[model samples]
Target chain A: MKKYIAKRVLNALFVVWLVATVVFFGLRAIPGGPVRTMLGAEATEEAVNRMRAELGLDQPLYVQYAEWMLDLITLDLGQSLTSGEQISVMMASAVPRTLSIALIGVVVGLGIALPTGIISATRKGQRSDYVATVAAFLGLSMPAFFIGILLALVFGVWWGVLPIVGYAPLQEDGIVEWFRRILLPGISVGVPYAAVVMRMTRSSLLEVLDAEYMKTAKAKGVGRTTRLYKHAMQNALIPVVTVAGIQIALVLVGSVTVELVFGIQGIGRLLVDAILDRNYPVTQSVILLVAAIMVFMNLTVDIIYTFLDPRIRYGDEAS
Target chain B: MTMLEIRNLRTEFETQRGTVTAVNGVDLHIDNGEIVGLVGESGSGKSVLAQSVMRLVEDPGEVTADELLFKGEPLLEKSEAEMTAIRGNEISMVFQDPMNSLNPTITVGEQIAETVRLHQDVGESVSLSAEMKRKIIGASKASESWRRAIEMLESVQIPHPESRATDYPHEFSGGMRQRAMIAIALSCEPDLLIADEPTTALDVTIQAQILEELHDILEVFDTSILLITHDLAVVAETCDRVNVMYAGEMVERATARDLFENPQHPYTQALLASTPQVETAVDELKPIPGTVPEPIDIPYACHFAPRCPEAKEECFEVDPAFRRVGSEGHEAACIRREPVDGEVIENE
Candidate 1:
C-alpha cells in the first residue's frame, strides 16, 4: 500500500510539472506579450525594450522557464507584470476563495444527489421518482451562470434574504456570514453537478439493486432498510465515487463562471483578469494550482476505492 | 405430520408480452423429516414453485393459491410482517448460484449471524436459569452471534470455521461457498429448508461432496427439505418422494422407488428413457423431441400432448387430472392406466 501511494504521488508530481510547463509555454505563445499589454499603445520601442528586459521577457524561453521553475521550487511566485503586486500574495487569497466555493458546491451537490438518487432508484415508476427526474433534467439543462442570475433575482433582489454579490473570508467575517456569502454561488455551481451525480447514482444503484446478491439478501428476510442501505448502497457507491472524482474538475471549471456572476475575487476570476491583462505569472500559477488540486482529488478517490472494496488492492495483483 | 402443504398454488408474472403463468394450479406437500424432490426441466417453474413456498417472488410476479398452509395454518392469510417473521425463522431457502448468493462485502459469518439475529429475539428472556439468561443477554451482542455463526459453519463441514468466519464470500471456493450458504439457511433451525438447484452449479466431484454435506445436515438438523433440481440422478439419490413437473403442473407423483421402477406418465417415461444410465450402453441418447411451449402459448387442454408420442385424440381434447395408477399413493396425469411397454414410439 505504501509503495502504491508513493508511486501515485510521483505520478501526481509529474502531472503538475507537465501542466506548469504547458501553461508557461502556451501563455507566451499568445500574440500579445505582457510588455505590450503593460505599456499600452502610447509606449515607444525603447520603453518596451526596457520593460521587457526588466521582466526577464527578453531572455531565451528555456532560461526564463528554468528560472521560473527554480522560483516555483522555492515557493516564490514573483510579481504580476500588470499590477506590480506579489503574485504569491494575490494567489494566497484567490485560492482560498475559489477552494471554499468549490468545496461547498461539491458538498451541496452530494447532499442533494445521494438521498434523491436512492429514493428515485428504490421508488422507480412512482410519483416521487418522476418529480425528482424532471427536476434533475431542469438542473442539468440550465447553465451555472444562468442559475446564479436566477438565484440572485429571486433570493437577493426580490426577497432580500441574501447578499446578491461579493465574497467574505471566513477568518474575517465568521462562519455564519461566510456561509451566507458563499451559499448562492455554491448552489449555482452545485445544481448542474448534482444532476450529473444524481443520474450516475440512480443508474449505478439500480443495477446493483438488481444483482443476484441483493436477491439473496431479500430471500434471507433482511429488512428493507438494511437491504437497501447496507447491502445495495455500498456496492452502488463505487461508481458514484468515480463520477464524483470526475466532477471535481467540473466543479472547478463551473466556479470560473460562477465566481464572475457572484462578483467573488477567487482564483477563477483572477485567471480571467490575468488573461485579459496578459499577466503571465498569475495565469500560469493559477492553472498549475488547479491542475495539482485535480490530481490530488483523483488520488483521494483511488484510495477510497480500496476502502469500499477490499479486493481492489493496487499493485498487489501483478506482483 | 405435514410441515407444509400447497393446494392449487399458481404464480404468474406480468411481462411486456402478457401475464405468463409460470406455475399453474399445483398441489404438493412435505411431511416432517421428509426430503421431497421437485423434478422438472429448466423452464418448468420448479424454482418459482420453491420461491412461492417462501413467498420470495417480488413485484410484477403474483403468487395466488387457494390454500398455502405451513404447520396447518393458512400462510396466504398472513400479513407481510407476519410472513417476514415466519421466513428465516420457521422456513429458509438456499438459492441456485452459490457464487453470487452471498453479499460480497459482508463476512460469511455476519451473513449467517444476521439470519439468526433477525429471527431469534436474542434479548428477550423467559427462562429463570442463570446460564439461559446469560445466553439470552449475550445473544444481542456481536461476539455471541459470531460464535454461533462459526458453529453453524462448522455444522456444514467448512474447515477452519473459526478463521474462515472473518473471511468474505469471495475468499471461499465454489463448494465452500455453497456450504456457507447452507450454513446461513440452516442457522435459525427452520422447520422447512428449500434447496433450489443447490448442487447444479457445482462440478460432479463437488456436487457429491455437497450432497454428502446435505445428508449430514438432514441427520443433525431434523428439517424437511424441498429440493428442486433437473438432474434425475440427484433426485434419485437424495429424495424420498419425487414430484415430476411438466409445464408448471405435476405430471407424476410417487415414492422415489416407485417413480423409478414403474413410471406411469408418458412424459415421465420419456424423461426416464432419455436419462443416460451407467449400466445401459446406448449407441445414442434419446432427447425429448420439441421444446416446452412458451408460457404465453401453453396448450389449453394437455400441455404435453404436442410432445408426448402416446398422446391420444382425447388427450388433445381434454387435460388429464392426476389419478391413481397401480399403487395406493402413486399418481400420474395420463389417460393410459396399464403400463405401456418400453416401445420407442416415434413422435407424431
Candidate 2:
C-alpha cells in the first residue's frame, strides 16, 4: 500500500511538472508580454525595454523558465507582475475563499443527493421517484448563474431571508453568519452538481439494488432498510465517490462563475483578473495549483477505491 | 413434520399488456431435513416459485396462495416484519449464480456474520432496521457473531478461516463461494432453506462438491431445502422427492428415483430423454422440441400440449389436472392418467 501510494505521488508530481511546463511556455507563447500590458503602447520603446528587463521578460524563454522553476522549487511564488504583491499570499486568501463555497456546495449537493437518490432507487417508478427525476432534470438543465439569480431574487430580494451579495470570511464572521452569507451562492453551484450526483447515485444504486446479492441478503432475512442501505448502498457509493471526485474540478470551475454571481473574492476571480491583466506570476501560479489539485483528487479517488473494494487492494497485493 | 407447504399458489406479473401467470396453481410441500427439488427448464417458473415462497418476488409480480405455510405457520398472513424474522432465522435461501449472488464488496465472513447477528445473537427486540448498524450492538456481541462467522467459513471447508474471514467474496473461487452461501443459509440452522439452482453456474466437479456440502448440511444442520434446479442429475444426487413444473404449473411429482425411472407425463419423459448420458454418443442427445412458452403465450390447455408428442385434440382444449399415477404419492398432470369415459389415445 505504501509503495503504491509512493508510486502515485511520483506520478502526480510528474503530471504537475508537465502542466507547469505547459503553462510556463504557453503563457509566454501568447502574442504579448506583461511589460507591454503594464506600460501600454503609449510608452516609448526604451521605456518598454527597461520595464521588460526589470521584469525578466526580456531574457530568453529557457532562462526565464529555469529561474521560475528554481523559484517554484524553493517554494517562492514571486510577486504579481502588476501589483508587486506576494503571489502566495494572494493565493492563500483566494484558495480558501473559493474552496469554502465549493465545500458548502459539496455538502449541499450530497445532502440533497443521498436521501433523494436512495429514495428514488428504492421506490423506483413511484411518485416520489418521478418527482425527484423531474426535479433532477430541472437542476441539471438550468445554469448555475440562473440558479444564483433565482436564489438571490427569492431569498435576497423577495423574502429577504438570507444575504446574497456579501462575502463572509469564517474566521471573522463566526460559523452561523458565514453559512448564512454563503448558503445562497453555495446552493446555486450545488443544485446542478446535486442533480449530477443524484442521478449517479440513483442509477448506480438502482443497479445494485437489483443485483442478485441484494436478493441473497433479502433471503437471509435482512430488512428492506438494511437491504437498501447496508447491502446495496456501499456498492452504489463506489461510482458516486468517483463522480464526486471528478465533480470537485467542476466545483472549482463552477466557483468561478458563482464567485462573480455572489460578489465573493476567490482564486477563480483572481485567475481571471490575472489573465486579463497579463500578470504572469499570478496566472502561472493559479494554473499550476489547479493542476496539482486535479492530480491530487485523482490520487485520492484511486486510494479510496482500495478501501471501498478489496479486489483493488488485496487482489494484487496478496498474489 | 412438514417444513414448508404451498397450496393453490399462483404468482403473476401484471404487465402493461396483460397479467402473465408465472406460477399457476401449484401445491407442494417439503418434509423436515429433506431436500425437495423443484425441477424445470428455464422460464418454467421454478425460480419464480422459489421467490414466491420467500415473498421476495419483485413487482409487477404478485403472489397469492390458499395456504402459504412454513413450519405449520401461515406465511401469507404474516406481516413483512414478521416474515423478515422468519427468513434466515426460520427459513433461509441459497440462490443460483454464485458468482453474482454474494456481494462483491463484502467480506464473506462479514456477510454470514451479519445474518447471524441480525437473527441469531441479537435479541428479538433488535428490530430489523437495526441490521444497518450492527456495530452499535455491544462489542462483545459483535465479536461473538464474528467468531460464529469464522466458524461458518470453516464449516464450509474454506481454508484459513481466520484469515479468509476478512477476505471479500471475490477472493473465493466459484465453488467455494457456493459453499459459503450454503454456510450462510444454514448459519441459523433454519427449518427450511430455499436453494434455487444453487449449483447451476458450477462445473461438474464443483457441482458434486456443492451437492456433497448440501448433504452434509442436511446431516449436520438437519435443514430442509427447497432445491430448485434444471438438472435431473443434481436432483438424483441431492433431492429426496421431486416436483416437476412446466410453464408455471406442476406437471409431475414423485420420489426422485421413481420420477426418473417411470416419468408418466410426456413432458417429464421428454426432459429425461433430453439429459445427455455418458452411455450414449453426443448426437443421441434429444433436445426438447420447443422452448418453454412465455407466460402470456401459455394456453388455457395443458402447458406442455403444444410440445408433447402424445398431445391430442382434447389436450389442446382442456388443462390436465394432477392425477394419481404409478405409485402412492406420485402425481402427473396428463389426461391419459385420468379415467375418462372414452379411452382417448390408447395406453402404449
Candidate 3:
C-alpha cells in the first residue's frame, strides 16, 4: 500500500511538471510579448526592444525556460511583466480567494446534494422528490455567472444583506468578514455543481438501493434508515465521490466567471487580467496552481476509495 | 409445531400492463426443524412466495394473506417495527446470488458481526477467550460480535477463518462466498431460514458441500429451512417435505419420498421426467415442452394446462384445487386428481 502511494505521488509530480512546462512554453508562443503590451503600441522600437531585453524576452526560448525553471525550483515566481509586482505576492492574495470559493463550492454542493439525493431516492415519486428534481433542473439550466448576477441582485443590491463585489482575505479581515463576502459568489459557483452531483447521487443511490446487498441487508432486519445510510450509501458514494471530484475541477474553472460577476480577485480573474496584459509569470503561475489542484484532488479521490473499499488497498492480491 | 404458516397468501404487483399476480393464493407451512423444498423453474413465483412470508416486497408489490403466522403469531397484524424485530431474529433468508448478495465494500467479518451485534445480547456473547490464545472479547459489544463472526466463519469450514473473516467478499471464491452467506444467516440462529437457490451459482461439488454444511449448521441451531430451488436432485436428498410450484401456484405438496415415488400432478410428473437420471439414456432426458406462461392477466385456468400432457378441455376453463393423491398428507392440483371425502371441489 505504501509502495502504491509512493508511486502515485511520483506520478503526480511528473504530471505537474509536464503541465507547467506546456503552459510555460504555450504562454510564451502568443503573438505579442508582455513588453509590447506594457509599453503601448505607439512606443519607439528602441523602447520596446529595451523593455523586452530587461524582461529576458531577447533570450532564446530554452534559455528563458531554463531561467524560469531555476526560479521555480527556488520558489521565486518572478515579477509580473506589466505591473512589475512580485507574482508570488499576488498569489498570496488571489490563491486564498480562489481556494475559499472552491472550498465553499465543495461544501455547499455536497451538503445540498447528499441529503437531497438520499431524501428523494428514499421517497421517490413523492412531492419532495418532485421539488428536488425541479430544483436540480433549474440549477443545471442556469449558468454560474447568471446565478451570480441574480444572487448579487437579491442578497447585495435589493435585500442589502451582503456585499456584492470584492473579496476579504482571511488573515486581513478575519473569518466572519471573509465568509460574509465569499458566500454569494461561492454559492453561485456551487449551484450548478450541486445539480450535477445531485443527479449523480440520486441515480447512483437509486441503483444501490436496488442492489442485492441492500436486499440482504433488509432481510437481515436492518432498519430502513440503516439500510439506506449504512448499507446503500457506502457503495453509492463511490460514484458520487468520483463525479464530485471532476465537478469540483470544473467548478474551479467556472468560478472565474463568477469572480468576474462579483468582482472578486481570485485566480480566475487574475489569470484573465494577466492573460490580457501578456504577463507570462503571473499567467504561468495561475495555470500551474490550477493544475496542481486538479492533480491533488484526483489523488485525494483515489485515496478515499482505498479507505472506502479494502479491495483497492489490497489491489496487489489476486481476486 | 408449525414454524411458519401462510394460508391463501397472494402477492400482486401493479405495473404498467395492469395487476400481475406473482404468488397466487399459495398455502404452505414449515414444521419444527423440518427442511422443506419449494421446486419451480424461473417465473414460477417461488421466490415471490418466500418474500411474501417476510413482507420484503416493497412499493407496487402487495402481499395479502387470509392467515400469515410465524411461531403461531399473526405476521400480518404485526407493525413494521415488530416485523423488523422478527426478521433476522425469528426468520432469516439467504438470497441466490452469493457474488451480489454481499456488500463489496465491507469485510465479510464486519457484515457477519453487524448481524450478530444487532440481534445477540452482549452478556451471552463469548469472544476469543474460548480459544485460550488471545484475551477474551472486551466488555464492548463490538469485540464480541467480531468474535462471533470468526466463530461463524470457522463453523462453515472456511480455512484460515481468523484471517479470512477480515477478507472482503470478492476475495472469497463462489463456494466460500455462499458459505459466508450461510454463516451470516445462521449467525442469528433464527427459528426459520429461507434459503432461495443458495447453491445454484456453485459447481455441483461445491453445491453438495454447501447444502451438507447448511444441513449440519441448521441442525446445530434447530432451525427449520425453506429451501427454494429448481434442482430436483437437491430436493430429493436434502428436503423432508416438498412443494412443487407451477406458474405462481402450488401445484403439488407431499413428503419428498411420496412426491418422487408417486408423482401425481402432470407438471410434477413432467418435471421428474425432465431431470436427467443416471439409469436413463442421454436421449431419454426430455426438456419440458413449453415456457412458463407469461404471468400478466393469466386466465382462470390451471396455469400448467398448456404444458401438461394430460390437460383436458375442462382444465382450461376451471382452476384445479388441491385434492388427495395416493397417500395421506399428499396433495396434487389437477382436474382429474381424486378429491378427498368432504374436500371442497371448485366446480361440481
Which prediction has the highest DockQ against the true structure? 2
With a 3 Å backbone cut-off (N, CA, C), the pairs that clash in candidate 2 are none
Estimated TM-score for each candidate: 0.93, 0.93, 0.94
Please provide TM-scores computed only on chain A for all of the candidate models, following their numbering.
0.97, 0.95, 0.95
Question: What lDDT does the true structure give each of the candidates?
Answer: 0.86, 0.85, 0.86
The 10-residue segment of model 1 chain B with minimum total lDDT is B339-348
Instruction: Name the 10 consecutive residues with the lowest summed lDDT in model 2 chain B.
Output: B339-348
Residue A245, model 1: lDDT of: 90
TM-score of chain B of each: 0.90, 0.91, 0.92
Candidate 2 residues B1-348, lDDT tens each?
888888989999998878899998899988888889999999999988988988889888999998988888898888998988888888888888889999987778878888887787544334545554542232233476778988998998999988887778888899989989988888899888888888889998988888898888889888888889999989987888999999998988899988988889999999989997665556777888988888985655888888889988999887686777867777788986752333232211
| DockQ values, each candidate | 0.39, 0.66, 0.51
The residue-by-residue lDDT of candidate 3 on A1-319, one tens digit each, is 6677788889998998899999988887788878778778899999988888888889998998999999998989999887789989999888889889988887998899999988888888999999999999999999989999999999998999999989888888999999999998889889999999998999999999999989888888777766766677778889898999878876897799999998988899999999998888899999989888898889889988876665676335344
> In model 2, how large is the Cα lDDT of residue A68?
94
Comparing to the true complex, what docking class would candidate 3 get? medium
Instruction: Label model 1 with its docking quality class.
Output: acceptable
Q: After aligning candidate 1 to the native by TM-score, how far in Å is the CA of A173 from where it should be?
A: 1.3
Tens-digit per-residue lDDT, A114-219, candidate 2: 9999899888999999999999999999888789899999999999999888677789989999899888878888998999999999999989988999989888
By DockQ, the candidates rank as: 2, 3, 1
Question: Taking the tens digit of each residue's C-alpha lDDT, what string does model 3 give over B187-276?
Answer: 999999999999899899999999898789667999999999999999998999999998899999999999999999889998988998
Candidate 1 chain A has its poorest 10 consecutive residues by lDDT at A310-319
User: Candidate 3: what lDDT?
Assistant: 0.86
